[model samples]
Target: MEATFEAFVRARGPALLRYAHLLCGDAGRAEDLVQDALVKVYRRWGPDIAAPSAYTRRAITNEYLSWRRRLTNREVPTQLPEPATRSHTDAIAERDAVWRVLAGLPRRQRVVIVLRYYEALPDREIADLLGLAEGSVRSLAARAFATLRAHPELRDAASVDRASRAEPSP
Candidate 1:
């Protein structure tokens, strides 16, 4: 079981970390969070977990929700997960703008955006993973997308494409 767990971590760790990092916006905290969540998954590992990815995502979202519950204020950004890599000032500014729009959202809205857009999870799966009703997921996603779309730059595909290109290689 230990070997099985280790193999699974090796295979899925990168993607898991990516998700956690964006949600928390802090690399160190993201590592800490994923490690903590995985410990729980390991404790409960059994035949019922027919889908490892789904199980792990539930753990991730649950952990993030718990972390958000105790926040003092939303002003202090949980530092970004990615290290500095952009070459130009414009790139860094664009990245910061994107994070500001995302991080400023309420936790539930943020989760909806991250899961639906970033992970490309369908509404049904997102609902199950986040323990939310399907209609609630749809509502939250719609509101969040509306907020994002309200930003003229976000609505422009060319700008988004250019911003994506500016992201430095990790």
Candidate 2:
């Protein structure tokens, strides 16, 4: 059992860390979340479990979703410095802008978006994982999309990008 658990951790640990980072948008917190979930799973590790990867993934998701964890892990953002002027066509800047918007979303909405889009999971599977009804999952996703589409930062960034592309090269 010990060797099996060790092997599983070695194989799946990095993926779990990535998933946790996507779920929470924080690297340190992601590591902590994965570690906590693994500790819980290790206590019950045995040969009878049918799908260790799925089970471990579920555990990590549940840990991220826990309200108690949220209460304890609340982060107060420090004041950010003024943005340096940069070209709108910069891919890294665009990605950073998108990530900032995503990180601002409500926890459940962000989770739904990440699972649905990033993880390429269907709504039904996400609903099951979140212990929410399918309709609720759809609703959450729609709300998240609406928020993303309507976000001022994203709108400004996108408009600038489009305008930059529209201008003919001198």
Candidate 3:
């Protein structure tokens, strides 16, 4: 059982980290989330459980959501930092812009988007993972999509990317 758990972690750790990063939008926080989830999973590690990957992912998502809820009202920043200047034509910049927009979304909405688009999970599965109704999952995704589509920075970055791609090489 211990060897099986070790093998599972070795194989799935990076993907779990990526999923956590998508959920939380910070690499450090993502690592913490994955670590916490793995600890929880390790306690229950046994051959009887089916689909350890799904179980671990659900654990990570639950940890992220609960952590966000705990921190939601406690942290109060006195001042906001100015946004960083980014080159419009840089693909990395475009991805950063999109990530910024995603980071701005409410936690549940962001989770829904990450699960639906990034993880490519069906609505039913997402709903089950989140303990939300399927209709609520759809509504959250709709709102998140609308917010992403309406973000100005994302719009500008996308246009720049499109123009860059469309230009013929000199």
Would you list the C-alpha lDDT of every candidate in the order shown? 0.76, 0.74, 0.78
Residue pair clashes in candidate 1:
25-79
For residues 32-112, write the lDDT of model 2, one tens digit per residue: 999999999999899776888878888988898793355764663222223435564465565566677777778888888
Position 58, candidate 1: lDDT:
83
2-76: candidate 3 lDDT, tens digit per residue: 899999999999989999988776678889999999999999988766889989999999999899988755332
Off by over 4 Å in 1: 73-92, 151-170
How well does model 2 score by local distance difference test? 0.74
> How far off is model 2, as Cα RMSD?
7.6
**Can you tell me which runs of candidate 2 are displaced by over 4 Å?**
67-69, 76-89, 156-170
> Which run of 10 residues does model 2 get worst, by summed lDDT?
161-170
Which window of ten consecutive residues has the lowest lDDT sum in model 1?
A: 161-170
Clashing pairs in 3: none
Q: For residue 118, what is the lDDT in candidate 2?
A: 64
Of the pair 1 and 2, which is ahead by lDDT?
Answer: 1
User: Which of the two candidates, 2 or 3, achieves a greater lDDT against the reference?
Assistant: 3
Worst 10 residues of 3 by lDDT: 74-83
